[model samples]
Target: MITGVYSMTLCDIGNTSFHFLENEHQFKVSVEDTIEHLNLKEPIYYISVNKDGEKKLLRKFPNAINIEDKIVLKSNYATTLGVDRALGCYGYSDAIIVDFGSAITVDIIAHNNHLGGFILPGVEKLKEIYPNISQKLTFDYIEKINLHTIPTTTNEAISYAINAMIVEPIKINYQRYNLPLIITGEHGKKFLNYFNNVFYEPNLIFKNMKLLLEMEK
Candidate 1:
């Protein structure tokens, strides 16, 4: 147990941001800011995809537990499997996890065995590419999109295409696996209406961190 802090800070360091949750409060801080601002004396539990950022975090909090080293994944996952994906699927029965962030991940876990997954470019990346590919296809609007119908404009087309791309693969996986679907990540809830069988658990990764702490004791 940490000597001074009342609760542990759990961080999920991704490609673009560092997400922190302590007790019930959560916030997103830049990796650099987190390294500079986080209290070094407090206990920290973190899972990271960025090696250099992880090193920075470790340097600041030498006692912090890297969640990757502590959690045991019972599966055939390669070394490249992300800790975020693992954390999202942990402590579940039979489930398929779809995380929509910098990149989209759809992973399966059954009977505690992480059964491999697929990765695709995220919607933001597609939006970036679509503009460069064709100036005529550009959509300058930044309004909330509803993907319930066919597109009549460039913005809607882009929204429709990316959402369809994300949804179709997930549908295929769900049909094949026939398991409960768990969706988590920055954009998980936005696609909730499109997916009928999905359970949106925004705090999955943090819950995984908590479970790790409990198991360690």
Candidate 2:
């Protein structure tokens, strides 16, 4: 109900899936993985993500303050502060952040940036439409295969389509920006082989919240 957060729900919406982390004194998710798992009921801090697999999450949370779309941030850089801090930690700024999530988001961070990133359906999004429209295509996890360009088989086609769409746009944008480029989220590491001078961070949004909270007072 209020604008401020006692706990931060940092959600990174991608083309494929949503990855979120809750951080204040600690970090946890509805589903446990890593970090210090905390008790859910008395959670002072909260984080929720609504990505590819589940769309219901976006509707489910009682306090669904749109981390990006629902709220207009003062600066674009603040939009990506979570992982930006990691980049800053490595002495880099003014780069492009292309997160390959449920939706492929191409964002331009102008040295000291602002929010309002371009949101596009991820590589798999096209394939997800296959059964209804194409009737000839299929889907598969892009990481397991070794190929470039679009693959020939249905499975391989999914792989190549997602990878090429995901990678090429990044290369073009990074070159145009001529600054450091960062690839993060679920699909980021899968295609790390094709790109260079890029950084891969798994928990950027969560880490960003931790860093921002530390700076307060």
In lDDT terms, how accurate is model 2?
Answer: 0.51
Per-candidate clashes come to 0, 18
Stretches of candidate 1 exceeding 4 Å from the true structure: 1-6, 32-34, 140-148
lDDT of 1 by residue, 106-127 (tens): 9988888888999989878877
Task: State the RMSD for candidate 2.
Answer: 8.0
lDDT of 2 by residue, 138-188 (tens): 455556565544456778766666566566667776777777666665656
Summed over model 2, clashes come to: 18
- Per-prediction TM-score, please? 0.88, 0.59
